[model samples]
Target: MSLVARAKSLANRDALTRVGLALTAAWLLLVLLFWLLGPTGTTEPSGLGRLVRVMGLVLPLALIWVGVSLGRSIEILRAEAADLRQQLGRPLGQDSHGRDAARAPMPAPTARPAAPPHGQAPAPAAAAPSAVAARPRPGDQRQTAMRFEPGQAQAPIDVTTLIRALNFPDGPDDHEAIDALRQALRDPDLSRVLRSAQDVVTLLAGHDVYMDMLPPNPAPAAVWRRFAEGQRGSGVAALGGIHDREALETVAQMMRQDEIFRDTAHHFLRHFDGLLARLVPELDELQIAVLADSRSSRAFMLLGRVAGSFG
Candidate 1:
């Protein structure tokens, strides 16, 4: 048979096999019930026993057949997946002549409408490409607010750099870095990462983690002012002492997700890092090492390594 014919036949066979598997499963269950309800006495010489014995033999064969069918179906699926991967990996819009549509020169833009037949209150001009290019970037805008979209392209988190940035004294430089990091956290894509990290922080906070660690500000204004002025009185020892297993697991999971989603989880946790820096602007490598050694978990160990890099 032709390759296409064989593929079609395999697809049909797979569908039929699936349907048969469901029906056979139901039949097997019914047979099992019948066998269970059969006579209990060994000396009975009952017809039900004989019937069950025959079914027992038949059931094994049926199961073996089903297994083989499933195996065949899986093989067919694997083959199909391989084919699809190969096709998708090829350049888009490739023709029989092997020309790449993407590389083809684009057509010139159509000419604009002629000058509106002598100024009957002339039509509005379309904005030129140069005008668009001259517009300020979002980062340059004074009122720029962080916005997150769930499906935006993700970049990996630079764990070492992030740790150093977070540990930096709260000066104008660190404040700008913190603002950028906070904006990154507001991204919707990091929602899960944020929640997970927040859960860990909250769990630790429940144990009075930040009670003595944070500044004893009389008001919110004081807190904000302290953060703005780059104050650095608190020591790194204040950030240490957390050793909870559950919280460690949560942190580990956040790190794993950061690895998978790249910067997604890492940026999300930057919010916490900034908050910690605000609480202890004088945190040094030794203090970071103390926090890192608070638990033997992989997360803490990784944090320790990041902190040690600064030394």
Candidate 2:
């Protein structure tokens, strides 16, 4: 409000430079006004009074500018916080107090059950259970809705489509891969493997371990057949044939250090193992070799080798 206070507020380097230039121009205009309105030879107000008057107007305008800038900054911060909350699924059924709206209590029934018939034992009232278990998430093998049994899935996903879907779509425009993935998702057994493979592949991608980049050492049909027949350790060591040292080291480190990646890799390994069991029984040696060349198969080899699934 006071002239000194207003000037002190605007006295920062950037603001002072702008105000100094504005004051210089204001001084000239005030002088010109005084000359036009002056009584000849009579006294006029001092320069300090004119300076205070001009500064009173400019200071309010400067405060408005600073206020607008701060307001914009606050709005941007609030918007970013909102986006972060949305990303974290913060509004997933909880209210402001953190109580789940979805789990709100229902009103009790007003009437009790009718009395049983005379001379007969009274029937017990049946209590309705409303707490249904949460459905298993995608890639969770605990679900039996899609899975029939290990090596016994009834859904007929072909070996080729199953392999292509496991690799996932090459790009959004790769309609063939997308179609194959869709078909695999429809199949009971292949869907489980594809979903699990997707998790492992994505995690591996974070470490720059791409299935396509890791060329596995060729394994013969007999090795795959032995693995399919439930052999483990040294008996199936040939299946762990990916020899890229860098990729192997990265995966081995993750298997030891990263819990999520380790679990996902194991899950993918199990599903792929089951898939091999189911399909190897139905395919010829040529089809088995082609299956080995698939990206899904490569990921299995990389993971199996690192996790010592094949010793």
Candidate 3:
């Protein structure tokens, strides 16, 4: 079934499960009444025959209720499996199977990606192995991309591209998002930030900690400006407006116990911090708010809170 139908089916299944449980409860109540009143006064079946009748009536419903309980547990297990597969860089959905084709990650492009003319789709990027997907640590002594700065590059990617790249592509068919990300990847520094942000957010989803759950208490433009102007610590802490303590604690716990997660989180933080420091100066308040609403920005907010970037 299509995902939309599958989602609706799950919803309908939940309702059916609830109704079945309620019916099972009603049957139990009737059983209690049968025992209390005893079949002496009425035509109600009694003795073993009556017990047989009750069992016949209750068994199917009881079975359904038990199945529903187990189904919920199975769903949890399924979600965790999907999360693990995703973390291992395996495809979670059918669309993800083609993500490598759509992404076409390369170490360096043969030609610089110029912005497509307005309203035209971007040309297909040349196929290359995904270099950014599995990045090496800085300690590996391999140089990584760091070529972007505010007003420094000759052909800077537009804010829309930045926003789209931050959100990343939805799936293989999300051509617009894919194209924007492709454009962003042409810049060394921006690409690293995008990849790092992508890794941490994907990891966070495994913990069932999503960016949307946090009430995005967006800091004012002045607060964002302070952050862009090289302020650090409490002076610009409001930028980390995400206040979901449960999520913060989950990330904090991960940071403590999971060495790999901690390292990735710190790497992502550094890349995002550097990129934001450069990018924000060029945007207005409205644009800043728009950027903040993107998926990557939400991840940054959550991680910053855990890392104490926001006081």
Top-scoring candidate (lDDT): 3
Model 1 residue-pair collision total: 5
Clashing residue pairs for model 1: 155-263, 156-262, 156-263, 157-262, 157-263
Off by over 4 Å in 2: 1-155
User: Which residue pairs collide in model 3, if any?
Assistant: none
Where does model 1 exceed 4 Å of error? 1-44, 94-311
lDDT (tens digit, per residue) of candidate 3 on 106-132: 122122233221112234323222111
Candidate 1 per-residue C-alpha lDDT over 1-311 given as tens digits, one digit per residue, 9 for 90 to 100: 22553476687777667767777787778778877997667576579978987887588758757776877776666665454343233322322223322222222323323211110112332422111011111221121112223444346433332332222212233344344345445444334443434333222232223211221111122332343344433322222233444544544554554343224334434544454444334433223322232111122223322333112
User: How close to the true structure is residue 225 of candidate 1, measured as C-alpha lDDT?
Assistant: 34
Model 1 residue 27 lDDT score: 72
lDDT for each residue of candidate 2 in 147-166, tens digit (9 for 90 to 100): 11234334676665665565
lDDT of 3 at 201: 69
TM per candidate: 0.23, 0.50, 0.53
